[model samples]
Target: MQVTALYRHPIKSHGRECLDAVTLVTGQTIPWDRTWAVTHEASKADAAETAWVACHNFMIGTRTPALAGIWAKLDEVERRVTLTHQDLEELTFCPDDPEDVAEFLNWVAPLCPENRACPTGIVTAGTRGMTDSDYPSVSLMNVASHRAIEQAISGPLELERWRGNIWIDGAAEWEEFGWLGRDIQIGEATLRLREPIERCAHTSANPRTGQRDADTLGTLESDFGHQDFGIYAEVVNGGEIRIGDKAVLQ
Candidate 1:
């Protein structure tokens, strides 16, 4: 197989950014992926949390589908994040600044439903990312499998809906499931496939329109016998991985 794409979401449930390449670190999530999360008024996460916590404490795309359409760019040097939406003004601010966090919540509030808890603040878990899995993870996807899903549902869905870190091509449909508990080498990095990532309602939302436009879970249950789309992998060896690199089952 071959690596086809790379991505990182600086803030969880906010936006996604494409990367040409990245350096993988052993036992860590992809760099800058899910570096921060917007905590809601009803969230139980403490702003001072020093370790990773469950994703339920954050204001996620699952709660507000519109957030799936938001786009983001991070200026790593200045630690500034820029968020843009079709209906909102461009926002640029450092996530570490309290004032900036407040501004971010206010800017994103309009997209949130009134019945749901409002976004309150931003929080981080030190150097580790707040992945959906309890363990630090890098999500991988198979393009052929995505195609199979679309074929099953008789509809096309954007890959962005998956929000995966690495996307590989030339794999058989659903063949990634066979890699579970096996080590795969991508470029110079070796990763152990952990488990299939369970599907979520957040994926039903169209990433381009921020609208609930698909029934991904429904189709999975009826056609695939399960609600899972991707696999989570733990980095076992640190190395730089780039687009177009070879991916081999090891």
Candidate 2:
């Protein structure tokens, strides 16, 4: 298979940005994927929780569709996050600092609070916290698997519905279903397929409009034969990967 598309959230549980190509460092995408997250006060206060940097734990997908449209850019050097939308230009801040982080959280709370309430703190690499998701680092999916789901739905599906860091093409439809426990090579990077990604209420939330589709989970279950799609992977080797990178099944 070939690398079809690449994406990064910058902030967890927010919208995704498509990339023509991406450089994979270690097993994760470089400088863009899940580098920041919004955290609840409990998580922020817990100095022992290193995994609180992931945003999936605190952000509710069922309540807010606007979360899907958020685009992020990360400046790794300066440790800054820049968020942008159609009407809004880039709003920049450093997630590591308490004051700046709080300001950003307050700024976006009104944007998505109607759908779901966000935590008061923003977490990033600079912060000692971790993401809310089960995984420590990244998420990935196969294009072939997505195509199978689309075929079952009898229409086109938005890639944003199932947000992932990497999108690989060229595998047979639904082939990713068999990849659990297997290792795959993409460019110089190596990833071990972990488990099937479970569906959540967020999948029903449209990233572009923030509207929640109650039937999304049901549709995945009824058509896909499972409430799960895509595979979670852990990076075994860090390296640079780009679009068109060969994904060889090892």
Candidate 3:
């Protein structure tokens, strides 16, 4: 298989940006992936806490599908992010700035439903990125598996719903399931497959429309007999990975 695409979500459940290439670091997430996560009113975390934690403390795309409509591009040099959504005007500001934080919170308010927990704060837990898993991990997805899902659903679906960090093509459908604890090399990086990623309702939400139009979980259970779509991997050896880089199981 080859690397078909690369993506990173600077803010968890906020937006994803495409990358042509990136340098992977050992025991780290995709560069800037989930670096800034929004906390909700329902969270039980200490405001000052700064370490990788569970997903329940954060507001994510699974619960607020409308947030899926947000798209983002990060200015790494400026330490700022430019965000765009259909319902709101474009905004660009540094997330670490108090003034910008307040502006961003207000700007994103309409996208969040009134009935659900409102976004209350922005939090970061160092550089590991707030991946759902306890360990610093990257996600790998197979295009063939995604196609299988489309076949099962009998409809078109966006792969962005999966929010993967690295996407590979040319592998057989569900081939990744067999790679648990196996070593795979992509470009100059060597990653150890940790486990299959049991999915959530987040996959049901369309990234472009921010609508839950598909029963992804149902189709997975019925057709595949499992509610998994991807795999989590730890970067055992860090290196630069680019589009079309070969992925080989070793």
**Among all candidates shown, the one with the greatest lDDT:** 1
Q: Would you give me the overall lDDT of model 2? A: 0.67
Off by over 4 Å in 3: none
Per-residue lDDT of model 1, residues 1-250, tens digit only: 9999999999999999999999999999999999998887677776644477788889898879999988889999898999988888999998889998878888998999998888888988856999999999999999999999999889888889999999999999999999999999999999999899998899999887799999999999999999999999999998999999999999
Q: What order do you get sorting by lDDT, best first?
A: 1, 3, 2
Clashes of each: 0, 17, 0
User: Residue by residue across 55-136, what tens digits does model 3's lDDT show?
Assistant: 9898887888888878899998897999988878999988778789899999999888888888887888768799999999
Least accurate 10 contiguous residues by lDDT in model 3:
41-50
Q: Candidates' TM-scores? A: 0.98, 0.83, 0.97
| Candidate order (TM-score) | 1, 3, 2
lDDT of each: 0.91, 0.67, 0.90
| Candidate 3 CA-lDDT value | 0.90
Residue 168 displacement in candidate 1 (angstroms): 0.6
Q: Tens digits of per-residue lDDT for model 2 on 103-213?
A: 787667656664345576654553322333445545678787777767766767778888877788887877887878888888878888888778777777666656664
